[model samples]
Target: MGYWSSVLLVFLGSCSYGVLSTFVKLAYQAGFLPGEVSGSQMFFAMVFMWGVALLFSRRKVRGKQWLTLAGTGLATGLTGILYYQSLQYVPASIAIVLLFQFTWIGVIIESFIERRRPGVEKVAALVLLATGTLLAGGVLAGEFGSLHPVGILFGLLSAVTYALFIIFSGRVGHEISPYTRSAVMLTGSVLITFIVYPPSFLLNGALTEGLLVYALPLALFGGVIPTLFFTLGVPHVGGGLATILSAAELPMAVFMSSVVLHEKVSLLQWLGVVIILVGIAVPELSHKHRTAAVRDRG
Candidate 1:
């Protein structure tokens, strides 16, 4: 039950991300730049998180903890910046495949940092994730028309940053309340984004309908909710499984795009979506079998 709860939390976080891209697209159509989108999202999310932390959380955050969570935010915040930049030149399909490399990158990072080898179970799950991402990205459907070298770099950078964020958020400041920790992390993100976009949001009609209409929802789904969910849940499951479970975002993104955005999804893409679901389940089932085996031995 505990494990399942963790899975539920990670999946919820992933789904929040799943819906975020559509909002980003809408914001762009409304004439917001990537900087504005990323900037406003972090600004609003940071403010909301701080309010939550102050009102509901009674715990006082230490200076060191602040620094650590801020570092984690640097990674998360950079993920948004870099991923958005990647989409500028590369096809979304190719960029997505590069970004999803975090699935295995997280696994590998955990392996090295923890000084442990990945078992066969973990390796198998990674294969499923990679294959599913390939299908989901329409790699075989000829959707990956062309690539940009810089966009590829940015996409890969996003994957590395995201993997680091996952690994650190799970490992750091476990004693702090999620609200407080998330606030601190978001503060770091706010700082990073402000540095990138500058203070233009103050007087540049940031509160205009175009930005406000989608910006608020983007911050909630893309920033606040996912941070809280991941901060609360990832430690319980470990980063590897949590990352795999996050594969939910790809399929959910495809489904939501089809339904809400009225985008056309190819049959092969739906097959990829099903494969992603299978990928998510493989780790859980493998863990269940191993647990049962240990129980029987005992």
Candidate 2:
């Protein structure tokens, strides 16, 4: 695929993720706890992805690759748990903002692993992202005052776990096909969620009528489609660009909430969104330019 085509696919996949939160909220309002919704979604996602994999690829799935997928799934599942728990104590907007700190986390982790620091552009992007998050989350005005300390802690932990997922997924990209990778990750998530909250499925009677209806769409959109896309696109996009594209989810969430949930968006939040976009875009554009320049020189 062409570079721009890959970039567009990544962008679309990330935007899909961005709009997913509202569906999650709808599921929650329907009386589904985070564990139940997330667990069920992954379970169904695995089934769907496996079906696709079986249809398309005759390649044998390897044992070590399965292990790597499990590890990735575990990381992905833990991040979900942390994020969902954080949502219980904080606003979705704030929780999302905290989760997106993964961009900086990715940069720092890459720096340590690669034994080289990020360039000036990356540093500036990180700073802008931090500032934009503060503004977008309304933390600057102490809006997070309502959030529990434990929730905040989990939010940060989610970012760390999520960053780890990005790193590990990138490393394992060469070893497995995207479909196989997605299936394994989903299977891992299923195991963890079931083990951690075994009773979630058993408590179906406790859920509202509304939640049952919501889960079907939520699982399809939030869990299945996006995971398939991420699995397919991330390997092509690279983790850093993937992270930046995924940040698009925040603005999408905000826009969706405003339209669907009728939530009010403040001026500062809009400004923050613009700033965050610029922060993410700058690095991507710079990288593309540098790549083109190198090609020209050669």
Best by lDDT: 1
- The lDDT values for all models are 0.83, 0.74
Name the weakest run of 10 consecutive residues (lDDT summed) in model 2. 202-211
- Candidate 1: residue 19 Cα off by (Å): 1.4
Lowest lDDT sum, 10 consecutive residues, model 1, at: 88-97
- Candidate 2: list runs displaced more than 4 Å: 173-175, 202-212
- Report the C-alpha lDDT of model 2 over 1-298, residue by residue, as the tens digit: 5666766766676677666567777667666787777776666667787887777766776888778778888887787778778877776777788888888887788778878877887888878877888888887787888678998999899889887776666677465667777777778877887787674554566434455466566557656666667676676766766676667777877777778867667889878888888887877788789999999999
Q: Residue 227: error of model 2 in Å?
A: 2.6
Question: Best-fitting candidate, measured by TM-score?
Answer: 1
With candidate 2 superimposed using the best TM-score fit, by how many Å does residue 287's alpha carbon deviate from the native? 2.2
Per-candidate TM-score against the hidden true structure? 0.94, 0.91
lDDT of 1 at 20: 71
Give per-residue CA lDDT, model 1, range 1-298, as digits (tens): 2877877998899888777767776677677788988988988999999999999999898889989999999999999899878867664445556777888889899999889997787788888787888787877876655566798899899999988988888999899999999999999998998898785765898767578777799899989999989999899999878888887877877776677667667788788888888988888898899899999999
